[model samples]
Target: MESTAIGLWGIPLAILAGAIRVSTPFIFVSLGETITERSGRINLGLEGTLVFGAMTAYAIAVVTGSPWLGVAGAMAAGASFGLIHGFICRWPKVNDIAIGIAMMQFGLGLAFFLGKPYIQPAAPHLPSIPFGFWSGLPQIQAALDINVLFLIGAALTFALRWVLANTRIGLTLRVVGDSTDAARAMGIDPHRVRLVATAVGGAFAAVGGAYLSLYYPGAWNEGISSGQGLMAVALVIFARWNPVGCFLAALLFGGAGALGPALQSVGVTSGYYLFYAAPYALTLVIMIATSSPNRPVPGMPGALSLTK
Candidate 1:
């Protein structure tokens, strides 16, 4: 039942399973933040957006009995929040960071108020593809039970990477991110582009939320996120804002996240709690390594306020 089936081998297997399961949310959120940052704006408020999206997805699934609809609702809610953040930040003298923080608080408060009724309801869970069906072992089957959204997010990472490198829209986004003056010179509306990018980013973040409530944790609660949305910021920096890199970084973080449970499954009770903090420790290490003033991070968008 535990990691006893395959002896010590089950530890890595459990971690692998956990990595695939836990990394889905990170994949989506990091990719979303990558897009937003690539457009020269930052949205720290995605933490709020992620929680609200989870609540919206859970409530919608309970009411509509359709997990997909729940995902859609979450996306709409997240996008709307992104649009609001973009619009408000566009006003003179308004800081993006300040607006993002304000939006985060507002979203959390709103979600808590609206989500109370949904705490007791059970919703339809999202389906997963049994990639391990060929195996007779239950452990193997369970380990290979990959979710549909994980596939979608994985595919989207490569797709997004290609789009950013090859498309006109990508060019415009890159230009806007690199230099506002250059975007204006090319007759592009930087503000409008950023607004749209932020919205798109929010939609991606909400899908991550959908994955959380509708799949993994499979419930609605105030504490569902556990800062995955916020941690995505550091992830983006670690990956240098590349979509493909984001996907891989997410898997690493996910593996780290899975360490504790994997250890517990193997009957190693001692200090397993510390293993849960592996992802946070990884984040801090990445930040320290990348934040040297002498050597600026390459590939960082020049126009991003993070540069300032």
Candidate 2:
């Protein structure tokens, strides 16, 4: 009876651990997407941006022997990708969403091409904080090895939430996203605002990718990313564009992602491949539940193309 109770408890504990392990990328990417979406531009190319960022980060870390440098490199690559997307979108008659998809393909190609050499090289990994030191259990200690990115992501979420609600710059971004014409009328260049926002968004997304390659999975490969970047976009919607909500939604996604493997560990033998669909299925269900036929939610940016 005690063993049975412990086994049941392990499920929730494993879920929590999975959340910690998996939520970092989701938080960063969703937050980045939030910024871009808030500025009336969407970078669907984040998938590519993420892959390229991972490759850049891993390669740089391998060369420099510093994980931090890899993060910086990832940010630089991401910003450059964002700038390209922004520049293209600024051109008259260019479809930003379509451009984003194109960028993703381009990024993937570049990553595969460049990262080919670094596939076998090992890079320095980011440091982790062990919060479970006192638990005296190997599983607990492993579970509590929280990555720095998770803390940074959490802090950024609070900071962004505060900025969007109170700061002058946030107000400008909101105006630019809600109505480009209004922003232009106020002498604020919507293009400039969007460009900056997208750049910042890309930087965050890239960091998420870096975390994936240099920490969690901690390897360089063409298949390092598994739709995390794209799913993050959907997560942004499920989060209702709130940074804090993004954090919570990310944890949910992480749990969904962990379910299949965790179940397999416990001798459960049903629908392994289909179990992988949990996160997407949940996202779809949430979207259906939240969407309305009449009007947009209050916090949603007015100019967001997705909402329309």
Candidate 3:
């Protein structure tokens, strides 16, 4: 029913297409993580938030026949998770990282259990723009058929970068993240700002999950997310918690992920599985390159637990 292309030239094109497709989830998750971390809180549980959001988005889409509505539901669910994490961490002597790990497992279990029945059902997919229509080459047309969310993610990246650099809320977040004491001294509630930031972070991650289930791969299942959430944590580190950097880092991961399929498309199967490891390898490389025992990566938020 589908025709595969046959040409050495297609390899690069294939990689380009795959990069856009695969990087979308990364873009969203890292952007979300950027927000949370910038507020001086880390949310490793985003993997769970991402998974549960996938389940929620898929389930609602199937029931309501409107993927947009499903996305809204996913955002609400993700925000609830973020709120739970933020609130618990505010308690005296609480461990945020451990809570995030526990939440990740809980989200996975809950999603797997509730998503069982709905896996077999089909849902409406999000729409994409045909940017490649002008190209006579089918591969180019396919490569340019980008989802609207990717565009939105790009816009958010720029908007976030600007907001963080210029806005009053941005100033508050920076103060809260750099020194909780300073925030309190200025009559700003660090806890309140962090809580809101985490909620926003969760909402963004949920949209990424929505893209996963309702767009790419275009289905609901137990295996919809394969650690994209976790990878995003490393991505945030790699990006130095900068929104623009997160967007570029996401695209890099996406390109790495697409490398495998691009090679396969060119009939290189000798190390197909190895190609799948590209993103992880790239992640390790980035972390190693940006870090050392000598000093914290430049731009790391001072109040971050990792930095401490």
Q: TM-score: which candidate is best?
A: 1
Over 4 Å off, model 1: none
Q: Which pairs in model 3 have colliding backbones?
A: none
Ranking by TM-score: 1, 3, 2
Task: Rank the candidate models, highest lDDT first.
Answer: 1, 3, 2
Q: Each model's RMSD to truth, in Å?
A: 1.0, 2.1, 1.5
In the range 74-168, model 2's lDDT, one tens digit per residue, is 99999999999998899998989899999999999999999999999899999999999998666677778899999999999999999998999
Off by over 4 Å in 3: 1-6
TM-score of each: 0.98, 0.96, 0.97
lDDT of each: 0.91, 0.89, 0.90
lDDT of 2: 0.89
**For this target, which candidate reaches the highest lDDT against the unseen true structure?**
1
Model 3: per-residue Cα lDDT over 1-308, one tens digit each: 01255367687777778888998989999999999999999999999999999999999999999999999999999999999999999998888899999989998999899999999999999899999999887888898999988999999999999999999988999999999999999999999999998988888888899999999988998889989999999999999999999998999899999998888766678888888888898899998898878877789888998844
Better of 1 and 3 by TM-score: 1
What TM-score quantifies how close candidate 3 is to the native fold? Answer: 0.97
